[model samples]
Structure formats: structure tokens, C-alpha cells
Target chain A: MRTTPAKCSKPNFKIHHRPIISAAIAKEQQIVGENEIQKSGFNFKKYMTEKANSVNKALDEAISIRDPPTIHEAMRYSLLAGGKRVRPILCIAACELVGGNESIAMPAACAVEMIHTMSLIHDDLPCMDNDDFRRGKPTNHKVYGEDVAVLAGDSLLAFAFEYISGFTVGTSPARVLAAIGELAKSIGTEGLVAGQVVDMVSTGVKDIGLDRLEFIHIHKTAALLEASVVLGAILGGGNETQVEKLRKFARCIGLLFQVVDDILDVTKSSEELGKTAGKDLAVDKMTYPKLLGLEKSRQFAEELLAEAKQQLEEFQSLMAVAPLVALAEYIAHRQN
Target chain B: MRTTPAKCSKPNFKIHHRPIISAAIAKEQQIVGENEIQKSGFNFKKYMTEKANSVNKALDEAISIRDPPTIHEAMRYSLLAGGKRVRPILCIAACELVGGNESIAMPAACAVEMIHTMSLIHDDLPCMDNDDFRRGKPTNHKVYGEDVAVLAGDSLLAFAFEYISGFTVGTSPARVLAAIGELAKSIGTEGLVAGQVVDMVSTGVKDIGLDRLEFIHIHKTAALLEASVVLGAILGGGNETQVEKLRKFARCIGLLFQVVDDILDVTKSSEELGKTAGKDLAVDKMTYPKLLGLEKSRQFAEELLAEAKQQLEEFQSLMAVAPLVALAEYIAHRQN
Candidate 1:
């Protein structure tokens, strides 16, 4: 059984075929570290824990065991199964940064997480990635039968929209509708499904390039992330410029998340990652590390982190922007 | 290969274990027939054909072949494949019944169809009903592989919401939000999924009662049907009383649909049904025909149809209610 890593650590630089980082990127990393630490006294770990706890509580309340217990049980089993809650945290953080309270964005936050969970469940199906586990637990299909798992995922997807439209408070219907549109777009053919279809079809094919790789990751991973932040900003009453700027920021960090994930897949052990580490390599799937080399991938992640933070520089409130800055760092540096 | 019946016909009452209809129900059916036909000179077939063509055009335009052709192709294969477009036409009919034009309800009409198509794709998966054909053609999974079929279903479900929120015109955002909420609720644990889980679990269980059977069909079939009409009414600026009345009408006809379907299942051949016939009996699944005798089931259906029509009595415009009246008749009497 795979076990999760105990702590976040630097990427394994001693791995074979990985070249040393250039002086420019090393210097850029140092500047980002100093600027972010000196700008705010925010403790990201505590903030994340608090936000995740609140979101979990809300999710628990939102999807209680009603009639037809099995499907609801299956849905809750996967949904409550632990992750870092990155998407919900990003949603809340973005909302707060744009002058909106947590309550206003809570439904949207839960919505993104539900969509994320649904994708994970379906991706782990026997017909898809065929993973035996997710987030250190038996995958949904392993615990429940595939039929129930599929139904559970479908229920979660539908309920996410229900929860958002039915439970969101303190936001105008127009803004709520806009947020819903963003979310729906992120998961459909033009969004996550688009990437998934391309990725599935491209599997086992040789000579895949950076363009195809980027297209997959951008849609599969970044689309929802971008939606998360955009939804928060929109619900929080952010101005058009603020929403657009934050959108760019989210895009950078979203890609950064994938790059870091690719680096960790090859560098870490199965025990360290909770999931099957090196599975991508086993499947001959393309990744940032495979294309750019490990050191360069790390450098790309750092650059994305820097660019993500740069988008927040005009906010003028160091305190307001600190959580987002730290979130970028977290995405860049998470080990598992 | 299953082939569709060429024409609609009355139920087959000559089968073994089926009794003749009672005089009371026969008289009630005659009264309803007279009331509906005398109220308006509406041509049900032309209205259905025109409405279905319009909805098909909108749906075709809504989900064109875009990037990553496989998933789009799969979605269109199931979505645009021939069906009666009952849900979309119901939406348009309900909209018109409440003084809204077809254009005002077009997006929602397409949305309900999208959701319906998604449910069908997912339902036909190997892990679910495992059917090899649908609508006289190969199932989505049969044509596109299970993985792509799943993704296509997901894409359609998400895109349904996206289309509703992004394309709905001449309606307030609040009404659109309300419609979205209704659509979402109809498919989640409290609605369709709720029924599906119960039905899946109850398969082959001995001594299943009419109540459990009703619960299943209500959620599995009626929920979406109810949402279709309710959404149309809501988006078309219907008053609260009108919407509620239509909701009742939708509920009666929704249950009527499944009851008639159950009756037809044992009475029709695979060719006449356009899909697997007697599969429910083969699996010993709980259905209306199995619970209540076939004749009693038909009598119940007539009662439901009458109650459904009764809900539209106060609409004050016989012309406005004609399409809905015809629609309920179409659902009750459809051969496949």
C-alpha cells in the first residue's frame, strides 16, 4: 500500500539525467522567497487547515445521508476522503482578497471541490486510469462497485450545481449565474473533458511534444483551478480588472501545480506520494519532467510561482494578497 | 438488431395474465378524449415535429465538433440520434402554455435534452444496464469505448448547465438561476440518482411492493420530466400558481410515462420497442407490470392521464394547453 509523505521537501536534484538549474532562475527563486516572506506574516499552514476544516464541515452538511443511502454513502465516502483541499482554499482566499467574505464564496468553494472529486472518481474507474487507490485510500470503484461509483460521481456533479444555486448567500443572482457559467465551462468538452479525451487518445503514442502536453495539463488541471479563482473573485465582487488579473495568476499556478506533480511522480517513491508514483512513466505518458528534464521543470515551476505572485502586486494590501501568494508557493512546493 | 416500431398503437391486452379494462376507466378515457379534442383543433403530430426539429437544430448548434473530436462525436452520436425529444418538447410546450415563446425556452429545451442524453449514455454503460443498442443504433459506449462514453456523458452534463446559464435569453438571471437549481435537483441524490440507487439495489429482491416501485420510477423518470416542465414554466415568466399547476401536471404525466413504459415492455417485441424487450423480466426487476397486473397498470395509467389533464383546466386558454395535452397523450401511447 502507498503511504503519504510526512513532510514537504525539495525536489530530488540527484536524480539521473537532471541538469543543474541556471544562475538566473536560482536568483529569481531567491528574490521571490524573500519578497513573499517579508511582505506578510501569514501562516499558510494554519490558514489552510482552518479553511479546509470549514469547507469540510460545510460539505458534510451539504451532502448528508438521505434516502437511497448507498449512493449518498459512496458520494460522501470519496468526497470526505482527505485531500489538501487546494481548490476550495484557493476559492476562499481569492474571495477574501477581493473584499468578499468567506460565507459569500462558500458554496462556490464547495462546488469546485465537488467537481474535482467527481473527476477523480471517474478518472479512477476501471475503464479510465484504472487506479486502485486515490489519496491513500481505496478508490471509489474499489470500495463501491463501478456502477455505484459512476452514479455517485454523477450525483456529485449534479449536486454541485444544486448546492451552488440553492445555498449561495449574500451574492446577487447575476454574479451567482456568472460563477456557475465559469464552473460549467471548466468541466465540459471545452475544459477538463477536452484535455482528458486528448490525453486518453494520446496514451502510448510516441513523439508527443510540449504543445500537446501543455494543452492536456492546461485543460485537465488548470481549467478547474482557474474556475475556482475566477468564481471566488466574481462572487466576492471583484472588479473586472481584478478578476482578469487573478485569472492570469490562477492560470500560472494551475500549470505550476501540474509541473510540480510531474516532478514528484518520478522523484518520489510510491510510499511518499500515496498514489502509485512513477505510474505516468510506467504508462509512457508525457510529463513536464520527461520533456523539460527534472531541473528545468523545477525551474519552470518557480517561474510560474513568481508570475502568479506578480499578478497580485497591484492589490496594494499586503495582508489581503498574502494568502494567495502563499498558496502559489504551496502549489509550487507541495511534495505529494 | 432491435428495430423501432413504425407506428404508435394501443396496448396489447390479449397477453396472458392481463385482464380487460373495467367499464369505469373506459368511460373516463372517453370523457378525457372528448374534452381535450373539443378544446382545440391542434395537430399534435405537426407541433411535435416542428418543435423537435427546432430543438434538434439548437442542440446541434450547441454541441458542434470542436477540438478533441472523439468526445464531441460521442456526445453528438447519442444526443442527436433520433428520439421523440419528449423532454425538450415538453419544455417548449410548458413555456408556450405559460405565455412564453419557443425562443425564450430554447436554451432550456436543449439543456434538458442534453441532460437526458447524458443520463442515457451513462445508464447504458457495461457496469449499468449494459445495453448494446439504443434508439435503434449502437450505444455510446459501443461506438466510442467506455472511457470516451463516460467522458462524453460528463461533458454533456456540464455543458447542459453551461448552455443554460450562458445562452438563455429574455429571462432574468434570477429565473435562470432558479431553473438551473431545478435541473440540478432533478438529477442528484434526491431525484434521479435516488431512484436509480434504490432500483439497482432492489433488483431481484422478492416481494417488492408498489410503493418502492413507484419511488424508483418517480425519481428515475419523473424527476427530470418534472424539472423540464418546471424550468420552462419558470423561465417563461409564469406566475407561481401557473408553475405549481404545471408542476402537478408534469408529475402526473411523469409517472404515467413510466407506467405505460412498463406495460409496453412485456407487451412489445424487441423490434417494436427499438431496444431490448423483456430484459426487466429476464432480470426479475420490479416494474409496474410485475407489481400490478397489466390491465390494472393500464387503468392506473388512464387515471394518471386524466389527473394530468385536470391540472391544466384553469389555464384559461385551451390553445395554450393543447400541446401539453397532446404531449401527455403521446407519452402514454408511444410504441417505443
Candidate 2:
């Protein structure tokens, strides 16, 4: 789930009167460890660490300080500042699940991470969300002036397409073009930008309902996540049916990721979250918790998780889908 | 030549003590209609009008007002706002010159224009050049607000890649990928972004030299021009030698475009240019005319025009090369 910092300050708006679930109670309801991971005996924790480390190394190598040091420095700073590597991990997992090796997917995995980082940088700009802190460090605009921050984002966005088109190896150019198309759609008007524009307009709008909220999250958050998995499946040689199934699975989790993010915002503190927490409340922004009540939001999250896992069941190999199952759980249970 | 509006006001810096050429004298030196166009009898004005009309129509069809109307509106507002359509025209002419039809290169032509429009939107942001007007109209930020303006630019950038990858037909996938790579490299840190970053940093510094000024324009201006022509050549099935030659030809004209821009800044009025005139001097920014003096700048432009046309001589068909020869002259003599 992506975290966009609050645009304005203080909580003057009233909260919903629905029964609220405390943070402790939400944490106690663990959602994973069902028939999926146990049957496959997948060590998800170890797998995530190995994949993240590999992704980190690949990302580090993808960009280098060149001609003008400042822009490259700013790009590397935010990109390497570190997140959960959720998108890249998902990309690699999707590729491997469809019979492609890690090496074949590495370029694409790094490309998604780059796109995600670019989104974060742009969202944190003062004109957008006015974020001061992200991932426990100052936001890109705060460290680098707004001008450089903007350019840094632009540079990363351009480089994401370039890297995918120029560096992906062992894949047919047709598949690579298809992957590029998928990735581009995920970020353009129909994807991340759509979500961001809606979110920007809906800020402090008290009457916003579940449909609009879902629209924002689905476009802003779910679109890129869908692309990450879809790119992997396409480049990994997944057939049409397999790619479509995985896309649906990704869409469900993408929404689940945002719903959990809304839940955590109200539950955690800034220090624990590594970003400003309760930002939605402070800004009076509509969130899953605000509309559904904390308890109902938690239930909604669980339903989404179950729905996401159900899409993977038809694959007929519990072992192949184990990582994705654990990933949904990880996103749900993550503290920061 | 692209126009970047001035960031600040008042020209307090001292002008270089060098001989200057009057605008009338510069205009008197007609640089074309010599051996190239005169011999081939290509109607340059009619060709440009037809090509521009085709490109504008394609651009209109490329983007539609979709789900979130504001962002798409802003994109269409600037993208469809009238300009010379130089990049797209160059793209089509180069493709045709390389023995390919216009339909085969239309997607790429529109893609370059989209990228160009995106750059202008970002560069006009409050934090960047802070221009209040562009293309003789209120800037995008003034019309749509900064947040939407930024998103609009982002959408266009992402869509450029999507359109090229998704819409280009009759071209091999490998060729499509290569074209995407060329376009991406023109906009990233090593391309347009690189030039903007340096230009931002050098905004007020007075000791800027010829080398640094060239660096800024080459990356900022020439890189995209080079990409436009190179993409056309590559997509037109040009051999490696032909592509490399066209690349060098583009580089010459790219620098020539900027040099002419600097000269016109000192020589034209805002009303004549349709955008802010003398912005370089107003901001005390380094420019070709500032460093080389107007006379030397004019002389230098002549050298570049000659060199740019010289690279086309090896094509062995004067009929095929006339458009490029006339284009180099058009870029040199355009008032705005």
C-alpha cells in the first residue's frame, strides 16, 4: 500500500459513529497461515528477504551518478531509501510462478520499483500532498528543492520505460512491447494519475462515499500493482487465461493493500509508521475506516484478502502460489 | 526553437562588450533556396502546412476527455494549442526521406509531440520557470491549478510511451522497442531533464561560458530533435549507417535550433514571438547571443545550417533530401 502524506493540518471534521476497532484488536486478528502456505511449506519471510536484497542490488546498479550529479543523486536517494520492495517482489514472484527465472524478470522488477518511487516523489511535492517525511526520511521535495524533486520524478518516470525497452533480456520484443503497454497504462490517465487527480480533488471533501474512495484507491494504488504482476506474467510467457487470472488476483490485493493502509493510518503513530500517521483524519480525507467504521473496514480487508487468494486456487499448484498468498498476508499484517 | 519563459524580472547584469547585428540585417541573409530546394522544386511551405495539419489531427485523436475531466482538459488545452509542429513534421519528413510512408511514422510523430508538450507543461510550473503564459495563452497552471497541471504532464509522458508501443502498426516489435528507447533517452536525465537541471542551476550566474551554454541547449533542445529524426529513420528501416548519419545531422540542427532561438530572443518582440521575448536577458540567463555576440551568433547559425545540410548530401537523391534542407532553413528563419 502507498502512503500519501496529508495535504493540510488538524482534525476539525467529525468521525463516523460506527463501532470502532482498537489497534490491538485489529492486530490480534491474523489473516494468514491457512491451507495455502502450510501445504506448500513456503518460507515467505526468508523468500522476501532474499528477493528484496537481490532487488536492492539490481536497483542500485540500474541508476548511476552521471554528468550532473544532483539529479542522479536525488533519484538514487529516494529510490534506495528503501521500502518493502513489495512491487518488485511481486513482479519477480509472478514471473517465477509462470516458469520464467528470476534473471529474466529482473529488469522489469526494477522498472516497477522505479515507477513506484517516481509516484511517491511526485505525490509528496508541496503542491500535491505537501509531505515532509516519507519512509522515515525527509521527502524528496524537502531535501531537494521542489524544482529538483519534480525533475527527479520526471527523470525516473522516463527511465522506467527506457530500462524496460532497452534492458529486458531473453524475452521476445513483442512480449516486451506488450509489457511496456501494460506498464504505461497503469500510470497514465486510466491508472495512477487518474487515482491521484481524484484523490487531490476529494481532499477534505466530507461527503465522499465508498464508490469515490474506491475509485481513488483502485486507480492510485491498484493500477500499478496490477501492472507489476501483469508485466511479469506477460514477459514470463503466461498464456492469456493465466495472465487474466493473475490480473484479477492483483486487482483484489491492490484494493486490499489500500484498505489496510487506511486502517493502519488511524491505528499507528508517526514514529511507528515511519510517516505521518492519521494523516487522513488530520486532513479529513475519506478512507475505508472513515466510511465503513474501523471494525467493518477490517472485515472488508479480510474479505478482499480471501477473494484475492481464491483467484490463485485454479492454478493447481499450491507451491507456485504460496509466495503470493503470504504476500497478501504480509500486506495486511504489516505495521509500517 | 523552444521558448522557456523567464523565471525572474529585471536585467541587472552587464551585457558583453561585443559587436551586435541588427535584426533586419540578420533577416536579410536568406540561408536557403540554393542548390537543395531550388533544384528539387519542393514546395516547402505547402509541405509544412499539410504535415502540420495531419499531425494536429492525429494529436487530437490521440487523447480524449476520459474519467476525470480536468486533467485531460488541461492536456488537450496545451497539446492542441497551436504551435509550429516542428518535431512531428521533422519526424514524418525523415521517415518519408528514408523510404517509409507517413502512416507508418504517424504514431511516433505524435509521440514526440506529446513528449514535447509534456516538457513544456512541467517547465512552466511555478517552481520551474514560473511562467504565467505559454503559446500566447495563460499557462496551464493558471488555468487548471498546479496539481492538475503536473498530473497532466505526467499523463502525457506516460501516454507517449503507451501510444508508441500500443498504436504503431506495420513496424517490427524490435523496431518499436528501439524507437521507444530513443524517445525515452531524449527525455530522461541524460536528455531534456539534464538540460533543464543545468539551466535551473545556472539561472543567475554571470560567468557561464560557451561550453556550459552549449551543454544546456544540446541536451535541452538538440536531444529531442535528434530523437525525432532518429526514431523516424529507425522505424523507416534505415540501415545502421543511415541511422548514425541522420543522428549527426539532427545534432547539428538541434544546436542550430537553439542558437537561432537565442538570437531571436534579442531580436524579436513578445507580440511577434507569441510567447515571452527576451526572457534570457530578463532573467540574466546565459544565451548564445549573450556569449557569442549577435553578429557571431548569426554567423555561427549560418555555419550550423550549412553543416546540417551537408550531412544530407550523401543520400544520392536531391528530391528525397529537399525537405530536410528546407527544414533546416525553416528552423533557422522562423520568427517565433
By DockQ, who's the top model here?
Answer: 1
Candidate 2 backbone collisions, by pair: none
What lDDT does candidate 1 reach at residue A101?
90
Model 1 misplaced regions, further than 4 Å:
A1-39, B1-39
Stretches of candidate 2 above 4 Å error?
Answer: A1-33, B1-35
Worst 10 residues of 1 chain B by lDDT: B1-10
Tell me the DockQ of each model, to 2 decimals. Answer: 0.76, 0.75
Give the per-residue lDDT digits (tens) of candidate 2, residues A172-251.
99999999999999998889999999998899888787667877987899889989998889988899988887887788
CAPRI rating of model 1: medium
What lDDT tens digits, residue by residue, belong to model 1 across residues A262-287?
Answer: 99999999998999999999999988
lDDT, candidate 2, B1-336, per-residue tens: 222211110121011222333334434433333554776688888999999999999999999887788899999999999998989988888888888879889999999999999999999999999999888999999999998888899999999999999999877999999999999999988899999999999999987876578779888998899999999999988888788778877887888899999999899999998789998899999988788788878777776666666567668777777788889988877878
